[model samples]
Target: MSWLLDESHLADLSRGATLLGTGGGGDPYIGRLLVAEAIKEHGPITVLDPDEVDDDLFVIPTAMMGAPTVMVEKIPRGTEPVLALRTLEAHLGRTAQATMPIECGGLNSMIPLLVAARAGLPIIDADGMGRAFPELQMETFSVYGVHASPMVVAGDRHETVIVDTGDDDVRMERLSRACAIQFGGAALIAEYAMTGADVKRVAIPRTLSLGIGAGRAIREAREEHRDPFAALAEFFAGTIYQNVRPLFRGKVSDVERRTVGGFTRGGCTVAGFDGGELELRFQNEHLLALRDGEPVCVVPDLICVLDDTSAEPITTESLRYGQRVVVLGISTPPIMRTPEALAVFGPAAFGLEQPFVPVEELVSERFSEPVAV
Candidate 1:
């Protein structure tokens, strides 16, 4: 029932988290680095299986809810989550047994670790989403009817709000975004206070292992001189997509960023691949992937734009002209295929009349045969 993720697993976990981010999860680097540093400093984070959680144990999932672009530049003062969690715990008149990660992609994934490390608590090994999302209400938490409000959203100096008005998740999302915008486009937040038994029932168990496994598959595949793409394809029933189009690789050519109705909206262009090309459009998280006007991938699915050689994630905010990069597409989860789920993230959601092409089918028709890997 006891487990620990070593420092060595960060990269794999990060990669997996990035994949799960499904184009909306912000870049995982900052989160990964923060968690890595904390692990290195305080020793690895102790993990527990969902079953290990007690029915009576109070659990609060922690994460970052703001523009990914602002995270790197602002450099968290590091006290937001620490303060937010403390405020929540204090209000509840009880201590938390373990901290949970609301979303496991990018910075959100790492925030819980930091909170747990700073507050000296055990971190539950599972989370609401296997990846990341743009809104707080879009998660396994919503499906489970776990209310995510009265939650504390904090700023660098510990300025915070304890919100709980029985608002729906989406309303909570809007409120958090407004708070982040007021705080200048980035809000470190935490929520979903539930007992360990509820967490055990609703949270996906050992999902972290999935990230580590997929990441290891990629590394081992490349090391063995096999097709890393194919290896990943097998890991997720996706096929290898070799049509890596040319995208500008350099400092961000130009960035247009703004917060609209609480959503962080903006896109950037890179100018190196061929006299300046390749652009990414994002809303707090990457939303669409285009290479010279051709759709490589889109949201409701996972599209990870990573360094060509190192496999590092380049944040939409941090991306610029002249930076070398390669974009990779992993299929989206089956959940997104359901008519109901698609209603929220399908092409129509982005104003595209295109129908939802399950990543499995997309990979099969666009890449290789549809075999696992």
Candidate 2:
């Protein structure tokens, strides 16, 4: 079913996207404000399901590419993404029938909405990555035979660069990362132009709606004074992300983060109230969590940190010492757990020594005795 995405949906959608981002994907607050302003100028956006799109329709995925830390400090001019879209459309000599998110992360999730509203085009309710990752090549589109070129990138000052790497997604990532660094550590991009048929085959379906649902569940749980983490688990009971495990409840003890090579790379530790510690590592998103020197959860599974009291997600860039937080381990969609998908984004892809294990398996092995909620 199709639905109108107006300001009424922004809060929940942003909240859910932030959770799905796994501590990366830039800041949702900035993206939400951009969408709200675009809607005020251009009206609500139409969101179409993958099944509803015609097989021949041309769709372009749009997002911000850069370090999340830099993104928060270097705000977009609200014109960068649209400019990239227009440039890509011109390069392809075909008007985009619709726009979609390349990844379902905080800011990236809303970029397509902003582009769609401003361009008077409907947005697709799907994305390449069900969750966010740091690199351009870490998308299901790339894994399943979609080329990410000729890609168009636009900066805040209207600077634009077109990259045509054919099927060399790694080269594409390298060049685009360099471009982002040149653009002051962030730039808007439109890549992986695909036909509706390809979208149906490769894109994760209904993730936008899924994020909205997760956000709504969290909000309702808070209003009723119930456990938001439990609400989150209940909301994802039958979805692609089938399990949600609370890995640790603690206060942040230390952080060592740095923005380098167009990526925010770092690690942090959370000291459990009951006397233990959880270590989290990331490139742009939370990729690994270790408890007492043993791997608890590793990507491509999600490692999310939320405020203990409010269940509001905390991005990696926002993690601070003394914050009371709960770390979660959420299972990824099966489509993303496939051998091919893992090869592109598994723990090895991020240079982690631990092998890729399902979050459910890890939970079953490690949590034979429940520690706490």
State every prediction's TM-score relative to the real structure: 0.79, 0.98
Best by lDDT: 2
lDDT string, candidate 1, 72-122, tens digits: 566777778888888888877878888988876766767887877777788
Off by over 4 Å in 2: 365-371
Error of 2 at 209 (Å): 0.9
- Candidate number with greatest TM-score: 2
lDDT of 2 by residue, 1-373 (tens): 8889999999999999999999999888888999999999999999999987899989998999999998888889888899999999999999999999999988898989999988999999999889999999999999999989999989999999999998999999999999989999999999999999999999999999988998999999999998888888888876989888878999999999998888999999999999889999999899999988888899999999999999999999999999999999999999899999999999999998899999888876222245555
What local lDDT does model 1 show for residue 230?
A: 49
